[model samples]
Target: MSAPSAPPLKLLPLILANAACMMAMNAFIALLAPLARTLALNEWQAGASVTVAGVLWFLLARPWGRLSDRWGRKRVIATGIAGFAAAYLALAAGIHWALLTLPGILAGFLLLLAGRGAIGAFYAAIPAAANAMIADRTPVERRAAAMATLGASSAIGLVLGPSLAGWLVGGGLVLPLYAMAGLAVVALIVAIYGLPGGDAPLAPRDATPVRMRDPRLRMPVVVALVAMGSVAIAQICVGFYAMDRWGLSREHAGRVAGYALTAVGVALIAAQVGVRRLQWPPHVLIRRGAVVAMLGFLVAGFTAAPWQLIASYFVMALGMGLVFPAFSAMAANAVAAHEQGTVAGTVSAAQGIGMVLGPLAGTLLYGIAPAVPFVVGALMLASIAFWVGTAREPAVARPADEAA
Candidate 1:
């Protein structure tokens, strides 16, 4: 007889862990301007401090995914959370000491970079393992829904983290960092005790390993890269765009940017929730989402007022909401069961690369024209929609609904 399937509640710990990690990252992001001011660093330096983490995450995500495949997912996740917590605490301490002692600014900046890079390195384990776990636990048809739950958790965290940081940063810059570190610790404890253990390879040893360059993976991977890069471009450019286009003060521009992102997060949650119920094929979702997102970006590029920009961004986010989970599910479905971690890693790496490139490209383009990045992003999405609409869907084997 086949084993019974695992309950959906089994996914809770991993989802919560993913939320905590996202919270830490977003909290730091919310404080970037303040951090730069506190360290007496220039804009480029402040940006570089944040960029180091994304770079490391891009470099290390695949290796961490492979490690999760070799080690158990739970163990890898727990260790990563603990390491992130420690690194966060150390970063806070280093910043506090530097501010008080007037250490050479370069030394303080390097310390911050090291800590951020460490967080990125360790935190890489969570997504690969969490995604692999979702694949392990869910049936083929339910994979998109499962991935949506994971995506929703991340969206919720993205909203909460920045909100908490904005509220707490009034007391001190370090307060939010410490709070995020505490949250990471809580996630670590939950991961160790609540998460299920022992992830044996799903595919047999004789099965061929999935590769990043595999033809089956190419379209989904490209979609992921372009979609994430578009997001990063918007994120990096929005505040500057608002200030330039609307003649807003720095503080006002930041508030406007925050509102725009909040809209994006809400749209993401709504889309994922709606998507899980529709039971549409991943390719269809990708194509439709890309079209919607492209229109949103196009509208954003031409907006004359702040509200219009925000609305355009919301529409764009709605499109992304459909696209992100579908792409993840598509990548997951493309691979053999044993290759889940590897594929997850590859997806994560693609996102990482996008994150790294998006900001650089967006900022450079912004120097030429405030609206250039948004238009460029829209075109990129247009291409993705066309590609996914035309590309042949990969053949994924659907197993009997046995215990995951």
Candidate 2:
């Protein structure tokens, strides 16, 4: 398959579509804690919703990508979006089963699989496809900037999305979730009319189809998993921790968490600008992110104050912001045109796993000690940083031009 040739300014609609979808996805996430409380679940279970969704997102992303490769991205994306909207509507309306069986897991799987799949495929595939699309259309020398443009769309969407959801949902989980579903519908419309359609991008040639087996991805994937895992774990525990530690009420916790997340969004946007100006190698940027994230976790762990946790999160976000873009850039550079979706989806899968594990790790540690989760999470991220420093990378043909 050849790349889909984009029309003038076609990238704008693609970005707008992606931004809308992501905003909805995250807005719904911001409502998770409240949703759990309303459903009478414990903190752990509340966190589990997100963890479960992330796992679903990470695990199924590639399958969706591969499907898109064959069937066409727009079709797969629209299907995913429709399923996602339905799943949320069901969840919002409250679906509970009295009995546990093969069907119970199956039921839970479908709910999350459909809801999460919309995001996993829609968000993951579009970016990967768009990046490749941008790569195909832009000259190689300027591809990095196009990729940068691609990255910015998501960042800008995310920066304001949660707050928007919270304001819309105000006090109800259903409203926020419905808002996400509505956005998914809107995204589907945008995709149908706004997105470019042409011949599909290339597919895997027979040689080395599935596995790159490259250590370049290994180090970054590890970093992403641990770092994202820590983020996920903290997301689960920190609300309760804030309440317990600072005597904050549920509403206060929600407000504070929203604010902190917004700060994270801001940090990521700052990173986009900062990275454009920096001359650092990708590895260096990742390491810096790891160290900052480690510090944030450690600070949050030791904190006796809510304000400290908030402060620490911003610091961690700054580092993470630096690393995330570089990681994506490196992954894009590592593969051939045919395998872009596969590789990008594979990376997203790792992210999903980290998200799933984050809460599980936290819950396990919570049973032992409340603070244990943060410390362990910090150590996990730190270890990944160390691994990256030592890992022997694959012989990726450094592009004739750097991603500068």
Candidate 3:
């Protein structure tokens, strides 16, 4: 089938809502080390708090996705937004309280867990729910475009969130957290109002079962893990990279990060445009994107200048931007309509694992030399291009109800 025309209007509002939540969730990351200092946490203790949040996300993603499948998408998304707002507020309060009370660091560590968990669960609302929402509204052939747009939402948020938070925190440490809360509120409003309503009709009970041997369903998941890992490595370590590499001010780093992030978002939109044109098979596009991402990282790791570093990220994210949608759409294409939640959940869990593993790996290698993790990450991502490019999933023809 030929690809559908890209819906410029369908793209904006949903992405805007996702951006709102993304800003809230990621802003805390820039504050993680400072918050640890307020609670007197060591590097390990501080890092552990962030790791725990990822674990919760990894654990809960499947179950929550299943629930969204059975129940509905909007409610779960709404719940997550509210949770994000609350957690965003708590980060400021927790740090302020820890600074005042007994100087014990455990209080701040606990606060990180509580706050991070809230943010993780709520942030989960946007992508998975948006995937399902897009699935409900679009045809199978055009679904990749929808998923690519969803990916851009998070990238847009990443671009905006840090710069906004850094400016606020430049004014006062507590200010950024409050600003994140405000963004979450706006996201919640958009999510509640702008998104289309209700669950799609589900497949009947007699649908054929999923088997372990189903490459159509499983390969893209593995591909997602590889791409998500690269993204996570960048996500967790970008702030530290700026400070260590060039002695740039946090405010300057924030602005630079914003520019890089916007470029990445553009890459995501670029991929969506490609799918709209249906010029290449998704499998080919995915491998091409991964190759570009790997090269982007190599460029990033070798940069002698900060602008070089930012430009490298642009190169890398552009590659990843295309890969993310192709893989997600591929996974969605392999499944029955009723199984959207299941596939989405599994893909999410895989990405969550990558998210956790990437940071934990970076922090460990960072202790040795800051450059080591990026090199390793680049190598690992390069491995992805080979593995996925060679693997082919055979399409199975199932009954309409079974393919639901």
List TM-scores for all candidates, in order: 0.89, 0.82, 0.87
Tens-digit lDDT string for candidate 2 (1-404): 23225443457777777777767766655555554454456666655666667766776777766665556655665666566655655654443331112244345445544555444434545544555455445443344445555656666666667777657655444566666667767877887787666534556445354453555466546665676687778767766666666777666666666666666677666775677677456666677778877887788778766677778777777777766766656665655555556666666667778888887788778767778987897787688677666654443223322211
| Cα-based lDDT for every prediction | 0.78, 0.62, 0.68
Model 3, position 23, has a per-residue lDDT of 71
Point out where model 1 deviates above 4 Å. 1-9, 37-43, 97-112, 202-209, 243-252, 394-404
Ranking of all candidate structures by their lDDT, best first: 1, 3, 2
Least well predicted 10-residue stretch by lDDT in candidate 3: 395-404
Per-residue CA lDDT of candidate 1, range 1-404, in tens? Answer: 12215444477777788888787887776566556656776555655676677788789888877777778678888888898899998988887787787677798789778988888788877887888888877777888898988998887777778777767766777788889989999999889988988863544556555677776577667888899889988877776677779887655665666677767778888888888898898888999999999999999888999999889988998899898888888878766666778788888888877877787777777777888889999999999888777766543222322222
User: Candidate 2, residue 85: CA error in Å?
Assistant: 3.0
Model 3: lDDT of residue 96: 63
lDDT of 3: 0.68
Of the two candidates 2 and 3, the one with more favorable TM-score, higher being better, is 3
